[model samples]
Target chain A: MNNARRNRSFLTDEDGSAATTAGFVIAGGLTFILLAVVLFTDVPIIGPNEGEMAPNLEGQIHTLGAESWTNFELYDEVDGTWDAESNPEAKWFLIQFMDTDCPHCWNEAGPMSDIESNFGDRLTMISVAVSLNIPSHDSDREEVVAFQEKASLMGCNSGNSDCSTRSGEPHDWAYFDDLDVTIMDTWGVQGTPFIVIIKPDGEVAWNQGQNQGQEIMEALVEMLPVVEAA
Target chain B: MILSTTVVLVISGLTILFGALSRTEALRPLFSTLGLGSLVDEPISRRMIAGALGGILGGILSAVWVWVIQRQEIIGSTSLCIPGSGCVAALSQGSSNNLPFTGLEFGLFFILLFSILGWIALTLHLDPKASNALRLLSWGRILSGAGTAVAVWMTIIHLAFVDDSPAICPVCLVLLVANIVTFAQFHLLYTSHSNGSWNDK
Candidate 1:
């Protein structure tokens, strides 16, 4: 009987609950603030963040007149270790992630072709075609070829019979087929018409995702050397 | 993966045995019928519950840190998922449609839930005489059991449904082990407290 009474008294004490509650409250509040800051801040670490080394991209390259798809690795042509000052031939790379079905990509096709025509001497442009995984937004190798051909028709080369003429200039660059969509995931591309400008040294100079409400053309014009009048 | 899963199952089974045998007299006859009556009288320590809670808290915090790194796009040589690894593939598979944010939200929810439960359990353990402490501790046991169940179910989903390839999230595996160990500890606490064995210590 005495033991039972001692146990009952021991189970009713309220000594340290207040301190525990206060500690938890403070810790929880601090954790919340930390997570919020992490989510909102622009930390350049990976996934197309500006000033970071762009992730390596590889895909199947389909040229406008090619008989078969060929392998393409971005880093193979634009060496990550190549310095512009050491190698004057080092060319800037303009990578555009697009879907054949996206309307924004469709509209940007002409402007992108024009950019390639104007800056073809100083930079290399490549269009990475990907599927958005939505209804009617899907694309394949044939669709990629067709999209590039259409864009090419807008260029100075109007002799190609394979493509229907569009409003934009013809695109002379290669169109890569991201069949597995791995490129999209690597770059953290959320939507189509995503543009990234890689410096000659392979560092990401500009990422459209990081610069919301800004046009890729505006960024390119500002960053690229001014075209001299003949 | 098989070895770890087997170890977790064995530990969980032992936890259930101790939980069933330590307190209720009704379970005594059931164990006796199976010639396991001798195990019922075995004395178990309550001190391990604190250790188990500590492990859970640490494991959850580590997982939250990984989640933060992933969300912040802080990928480098030291990141949890390297390029071309299973972790990267799993992350890529879920990147569509803001799915990573959903994962972050869920992780935050678990952190809050476990943190609150750990605090309550610690308070009850330290001040067993606190008003209604025993009752609240019992609720903690139930909730911890539920939390463990959720962890198990998620592990199953990750193994069977996440992808065709066998991809394991190391952080997720740590969370599972932590949840199971904490649940077992809670059971041990219940066994010791109900029989008044904790007071002897």
Candidate 2:
């Protein structure tokens, strides 16, 4: 049949075979170029990092004395627009991402409180309590309140019989409940006890990811004086 | 996840090899039992087969790229997207759109399975002596139609239902386009073969 003969001739034809080879070569080359572009390009990230402006965060703040949660926004406290002379009243912000059920966060609570006590005059510490989505680590507003109660008792007078009582002053800082973990996603927090220091002008001075292996206290000690001098 | 990624990569490599060496006589016996031995004798069918395989490869690569970006996000690292660009916004929003498996993962799995079925169909259609050629060709046509339908639905979701903010996901778009092209090629191959364009001799 003519159709059969044509099919046979087409396969044996040198130009046809060459065209197929050229097409494959071009496609393969383009694929390689695309892969290279994806792998090598320096892409900017939206989340917080050292030397970058922190993303604006809005949440419900549970101040220690307040009976109900109050709305809080980061940009309200710290001006986002850069100013050479930072607002003296707008203290440096120390933001902590913690989970009530995390052991590390529990252990770090005492030290974090001590840090707050020392830096209370120079910085405003805010704790953003979040749920890690693990079954055991799931938290609610009540759990956050309970965790605050326990943290308030860390350095209380143990010699007294009423030691269990929350007579001691609670942490003199705002606490926010992120039970939905939306704030965690916004901050790209992968684990608990993540900390970030924001300048009065809203720039991130230090982030846990950028300052690997450095404790929050150490970073504060090293960076706070520089921030004050500036 | 890493293991599955490796498997997909290997399959993609083998498909490319098959397309490139389809005309070699040494490979004839290997595919003879599958009725694909005469693929070397028909230039048009050979090109169609190559096109389909190329689309599969593109889909696999795009899926892998998405998987890598997602892994970076999980580790709290910066993904591959320019700041203030649509890709960055899309990546930020993509975290909230969580499923048990990512969309790219499901797409990869579907395309890999589809590639296997498509290969069998193509070989069957080309084999003039195959007794069940017409029946298998009908199945191929139906499968391709279904694939096209799914691609269109997903494309609609991507374009309209993703979010209020428009997300320009170049990689996701590439993967969807590859899916459409692969199915279109399959439909064409089945239609041509069934219409008796290829000689029975």
In terms of TM-score, the best-performing candidate is 1
Candidate 2, pairs of clashing residues: none
Per-residue error (Å), model 1, residue A52:
10
Q: After superposing candidate 2, which stretches have Cα over 4 Å from the reference? A: A1-114, A117-139, A142-228, B1-46, B75-79, B93-164, B194-201
Report lDDT (Cα) of residue B195, candidate 1. Answer: 53
Can you write out model 1's per-residue Cα lDDT over A1-230, one digit (the tens) per residue?
99998866655433445436635764775478467746654444544788877776765787767779886666546453566456655578999998776777776778887788777777888898888777665566666676677633321122222234444655678888885778888888888888899887567888887788987667876876554455
- Individual DockQ of the candidates? 0.15, 0.04
TM-score of chain B of each: 0.62, 0.57
- Model 1, docking class: incorrect
lDDT of 2 by residue, A130-168 (tens): 877775665667667656655432322212212124323
What is the C-alpha lDDT profile of model 2 across B3-90, one tens digit per residue? 4434544555455455444434565454645555565455555555554665555555655555455444332233355444544334
Worst 10 residues of 1 chain B by lDDT: B91-100
